[model samples]
Target: MAAQAEPSLLVDYAPVMLWQAGPDRARSFFNQPWLDFTGRPLEAELGFGWMEGMHPEDRARCEQVCQQGFASRAPFTLDFRLRRNDGEWRWLLETARPLCQDGQFTGFLGSCVDITDMRQAMEERRRALAERELLLAELHHRVKNNAQATTSFLGLQASRATSPEVAAALRGAATRVMLATLVQDRMFRIAENATIDLGAELLATAQAAVDVVGRPGIVIEAEMEPGLLLPVSQATPLALIVNELVVNAARHAFADRPAGTIRLALRRPAPGLGELMVADDGVGLPEAQRRNTPQGCLGLHLVPRLARQAHASLRLDVDGGTKATLRFACG
Candidate 1:
């Protein structure tokens, strides 16, 4: 191995600014980088002179942390703004530790790292996040108002319909729209964290659909596994798919029956994957309808497209009744 470089020479020319202060809390040494950073000579920065370059706002806090460290003879870290040689203020993160010789307290040694760019980037990120939250809140408020207005208009139209079937159809449409709006409101409630518990949302959507479409004798129930945490992107399409499925089952599956049962289930069956099943114990799908899929039904039409958006596979089981199972990525 080659000879070790001089320790003092390395400290004097290190990339970061380094300094030392005596036990009296009076700075006694300044490395070349520290002097070059301030564009000042060693004598000009010795003792309490180095603090002259620090921002006025930071001086008191810096003094307090430094004084506390000095009094306790412990290592400490602090952040402050200091003036550069170019007269620009930059953030400096200072870390200092007590120095000892022969187990006896001697002085304090410290290093300063320029973190101005990092701090600025972090501040910009925080600002952008706040703006996004405000926009989402406004969107949620507008959607809620629009849903209520549309539901009321549809209700009025249903009341004017001469036929009960037409009135029921209009009410179902209103329910679907309101379901979307309500789910969005819930999503925005937790949007600040950019995550959603998808299972819970599915259960809520299923229950709401039954409340809207159920008659006196109809029963709609849901079995949902909680803690299916997923991103916001997954929430929208999945919620849409579930809402459409439930609404479809309630309207068409039980179209002829005075009362029936619709069951909804959600589970995280495997890692990075979620499974959702909507089954109705009512009239099964017609052979042609099951074979060709419902081209005329808007809800069924949207189901396949929504499944694709959610990156989920759709399987229809029309054994005794209509059962739609969807498996999608949760990660």
Candidate 2:
């Protein structure tokens, strides 16, 4: 048995500021909340008096929007700065709809909510995001320079080495340095996307396998699931394994062939396990040396160590062509 509230009472005490305009496109009424917010009498706020509180910079655009809506008898929404009772400028999001009486257009009704806090919060987030991107760019540049310098020094040492074995070892070390740098670059490019899943950085390295190996006749076929994520701590070692396998295939698989294909793939075959495989269709490994490391190929000798570092088991196959698989915990 609560008394029913009157329509005028409800409108006057509504949470949002409300207003009305007549068929003549002049402001006809403003509720008590609107008067309280602007510290103006109802008489003073009627017929464009409310416009006096709008920010000068937004006046023309806001007026134009209202005028357009009035002309078409349509609903309209706008955001603009309006002066508060204490003279502080505050953002307001206002929406209006045409009012009809007995199928005839009579006026418009509008409501507004203060949005100053939301506007300021959004601006702060934008500034923070811009600063983060700037820092990441600088980091990527510095990392690239340092890694390139190291690789250059290693190459120089390999060129100056006296023994064939020493030179090959130095060259292999330089190749490792280069591949590690490439993995870091790919990691940097994997954005914590606002749209899709995060961190499948291995996909970038897999797609560019042939280019990274610098083998003229090698074409890499990269197949990767879009959302396969890897642990950052193990990413570089996993990348090195793939890099070494591709390098071996490019060098030994194609002896006299002008073109060959290297199929590189990374997939989560089980709930908590991942697989990275590299296979090439060229010369198969000799049966006698298939079980052991290929003779004189210093790079393949280190694949087992790299696999251990990644906490992965290495599997070698010599069917039709050489296939290398690394199984790891990458859930």
Candidate 3:
């Protein structure tokens, strides 16, 4: 008969480390490449002896996974650290599938590849992401502090101004700046996904604007739809628009009354559209001002500009006090 080649020769020269484990979940065979990589003799690596080269922390888990996979006769993959010939621990990715002959499960055929470099790169990338998040949070904190300082300085300047018009202008500027700061603070505090809760943001901004005005008799109530979320880009402009309208209501709407109520409502009135209504039960706007003209107070001028920026329609109703309606497409 012709000389017969050894069955092991087929896989001994393969690039990956090939192995086989018997049905008992103990290693039965280690190819030449595997044995050479571990620098161990066949007698020393057969059966469960190969586990000695696995990291101590990973050995138990690896054995448990292998046992489960063997019991189920299914393919499985795992990663672990193994000692190489040079005594250095290297990461390895091992994948194994059930072996069967004549429809009877016999053992597990497995292959392992050195993945130390890939694991190191992934770890570095994770560290870089963590560092970036930390830096962004710190930057937001500094911005908030600077905004607060600037608001305080503006308040001081407003207090010292001799003319009422100049003082009012300074106060308005300070309030606008504070509104921007509130938006930034809220953005930084939210998750990295960058979705803003419209109701919460509007409530906070309205409350802050009310507090700044310090009107004891005037009550500002917000009736917003729950869980209205918008991206940062939309939220910022929408917040500024609401801030202007709310402040306008507090200042001009209830001038003659000792006590009044300002109701701010935000709702999704239609699909892909949002509406905001600022209504007050105080003095209504004058006929000329109600016409949405650019020739009016700072709030009137600002409302139109902000509405334009947000792609919203601005309408003023003077029938029952002053109601400002802003409808915009949300899509």
Candidate 4:
């Protein structure tokens, strides 16, 4: 007589649903958990009857995958919605492997776990992330608009100033505010990570500063890599430093010359290092300032402070014209 199957050999009392199939893809056994979950008896779940409880949208693909796995006699996994005993649909993760006995292929064994709650939780997290990104973008937009409005107010104040020196100082302040505003604007347009394209932002801000100055013969040129990215923390200080250097050049560098060219260039000279240069073909810095004292030039004094904030070294050279260089850690 054939040996009786051990109780442990059967999955009938297991918590999870389990099944066995014959070599011809005919159901041979369904554990108690499987029958209870589907609310079906042994006869109703035989052969292809189990497919009746699968969601219609998942049936075709599930069958195709099953056929492929069976043909290859390899372990496989699939996810689909199955109708529960309470008439509710729940997601399930089903895994199956070829079963062998007596050194020969006999059939397949499969197990399934309900993953409806996990799947729903994952979907909720995804939606929440998307909503947070949208809200952040909107906040950046509003901040940028407010900053630009402040810049305009400063411009009006500068226009009404009686002294040329006071007017220039107010205009410089307006440009500084605009620098931060530009950064916010770029952040709003980019992805959720809040990284700004350093080169592009610099080029745009330089052009805007020049336009605000309204110097008839001064031209701004940019030579920058296409997509040099920097986080806002680094970009803001670096941008302010550049704003100061460019404005300083436009104001004093070309005082005696009829026309001048101010060039802004960004280069990666070494790994983890970046170089930003502003060079102008105009009268060089005053002899006293070239000595690095920067007496009476408020913007020039602010340069060192801004460079320190960006963790960069600032250098000024007067060969041919003034060239301001800022070297910082980029990576």
Backbone N/Cα/C clashes per model: 0, 0, 0, 0
Best by TM-score: 1
Better of 1 and 3 by lDDT: 1
Candidate 3: residue 330 Cα off by (Å)? 5.3
lDDT of 4 by residue, 198-232 (tens): 99888877877677667878888888976677877
By TM-score: ranked, best first: 1, 2, 3, 4
Residue-wise C-alpha lDDT for candidate 2, range 1-331, written one tens digit per residue: 9999999999998999999999887899899999999998998889988889999999999989989999999999999999999999999999999999999999999999999999999999999989999998998899899889988998899999999978977776777678778777766665545222222455455545556556776787877666766555576677767777777787678876878888877778898887888888989776765753555455577788888888988888988788988888865
Query: Candidate 3 — which residues are off by over 4 angstroms?
Result: 1-20, 29-46, 49-57, 60-77, 82-124, 284-295, 299-321, 326-331
In candidate 2, list every pair of residues with a backbone clash.
Answer: none
Global lDDT of model 2: 0.80
Better of 3 and 4 by lDDT: 4
Q: Give the TM-score of candidate 4.
A: 0.68
- Per-residue lDDT, model 1, residue 214, is 57
* lDDT, candidate 3, 187-261, per-residue tens: 667666577778888778877777777777888788999777777666777778777777877887788876788
lDDT per residue for candidate 1 within 1-331, as digits (tens), equals: 9998898899987989999999988899988899889998999899899889999999999999999999999999999999999999999999999999999899899999999999999999999988987887888788799899999999899999999989988887787788878777776667544888787778777777667765656676778887888777777788888788877887777878788888888888889888988888988877766842567677887888888888889888888888989898876
- Model 1 scores a C-alpha lDDT of 0.85
Q: What lDDT does the true structure give each of the candidates?
A: 0.85, 0.80, 0.84, 0.84
